[model samples]
Target: MTASPAFERLAIVGIGLIGSSLARAVRAEGLARTIVCADANADHAARAKAIGIVDEATTDPAEAAAGADLVMLCVPIGAYADVARTIGPALKPGAIVTDVGSVKQAVIDAVAPHLPEGVHLVPGHPVAGTEKSGPDAGFAALFPGRWCILTPVPGADEGATRKVADLWRACGMTVERMDPGHHDRVLAITSHLPHLIAYTIVGTATDLEEHLRQEVIKYSASGFRDFTRIAGSDPTMWRDVFLNNREAVLDCLQRFTEDLTALQRSIRRGEGDALFDLFTRTREIRKGVLDARQA
Candidate 1:
């Protein structure tokens, strides 16, 4: 016998990598009775319906959100406010509005005011994804063994929060709760800074002479290849992330610059022991991440 669904109806705004993956995961686990995907890009909505990832797909955010018990905003961070505004009136009473945005504080700040009084805002970030986009890039396996962080506002409905947590757990993720500001700062170091560095390194390579550029790609099986992969992430999404989480990302970037400068000095001075010690410490950090299966 099929078990009952956790959500009466789930509205997914922005059916890209994360959104599509959520639809797939929810369906696989029978977490939502109905999955409605809304993307401003008509092609995305059409493709989502065609692929049978969603019961319905629409370009109108409000229309998709009208009867949904849970509405997840999966668009870029910059679009949060606009989406919230559009869907504000459509959201039913006691509805739980969550998100898959990487930046947390900005999401709350942008989306909170627009939501109706009775609707609960529970922002979330599923800290798992690939350097891919669009409806076709998603899969149910993306949520398993991953972490899902929820940043509920003060005085948030406990039942609503638990419901959201249970949904993620059903999708095979470990759920965590945190303050949105702290989540942003933590993610800045763990996720955003790395992406920024990757983009910078890859962009630098793009400016290399034509001959050197070809050689770089030809022999990119080294670390440069990994950076290229990270840099290939959705441009609009990353741009919005950096813009939305500017304070946290800038803080982390400053510290990273200081560390990088020290490394550069050590290299210039031929301080092999200092470089070796630093590398050894970083190696341990990588090992710890691997142990945690977060890498």
Candidate 2:
């Protein structure tokens, strides 16, 4: 006999790259009996339905969330509070609310208070994506071989957390539990800081003299092209990420600045050994990433 779907209904808010991707994965894995989506962009919502990824689509989050057994927030972090407020009263008791936001503590802060009694909040980050957006950019293949980190707040229901983790596992992601605050700190260095540097580098290149800027793009090396790809991510989403995780991002930025200054001093002093040692260490880190199959 076929096993029952994990949830009776799954409502996904925000039909962007991540949201649509999850919808596709859930359908592919038969994780939910009914799948629906809500997007601030009515066109995007309609697009998701037209693509046949969702059973229903609407611009109102409350409408999508009502009676849903699982509510997944894939909206920008900046919009979390407003979305939470709109959907709070509509959510049914015993429903599980989870998110794919990069910063967990802030997500819990924005969402948990709005949830009614008996509802469970499990903040999650799928630790995966591409520099693409919109429903057409999504595929069920995106989640495979990626990590999904869940940060269930203190006092959160154990069963609810396990269900959320299992949902990701069904989509082919390895799952790990983390403290919300600790998750923020770890992601600050691993994901947030790298994006910040990429945006800065690309912004600098754009500010160069027109001729020089043209040449930079014309003869771009692999490194600069990679930075451009990172910088091409959704602007509104990244803006919220940096603002919501400011404390941790700023801390990492300061440390990065200190290290950069040290590297600058070494270069000025013609210390070849210093540069060589730093490069060797960084090369090993890259090797480690490959060894772990995360690269």
Cα error of candidate 2 at position 222, Å = 4.2
**CA RMSD (A), model 2:** 0.9
Which ten contiguous residues of candidate 1 have the minimum total lDDT?
Answer: 1-10
**Global lDDT scores for all candidate models:** 0.94, 0.95
TM-score of each: 0.98, 0.98
Find the 10 residues in a row with the least total lDDT in model 2: 215-224
What lDDT does candidate 1 reach at residue 202?
Answer: 94
Per-residue lDDT of model 1, residues 1-295, tens digit only: 1867878899999999999999998888888889998999999999999999999999999999999999999999899999999999999999999999999988889999999989999899889999999999999999999999999989999999999999899889999999999999999999999999999999999999999999999999977999999999999999999999999999999999999999999999999999999989999999999999987
> Which number leads on lDDT?
2
User: lDDT by residue for model 2 over 146-191, one digit each (tens)?
Assistant: 9999998888899999999999999999999999899999999999
Model 1 TM-score on a 0 to 1 scale: 0.98
lDDT score for candidate 2 against the true structure: 0.95
Regions more than 4 Å wrong, model 1: none
Q: How high a TM-score does candidate 2 get?
A: 0.98
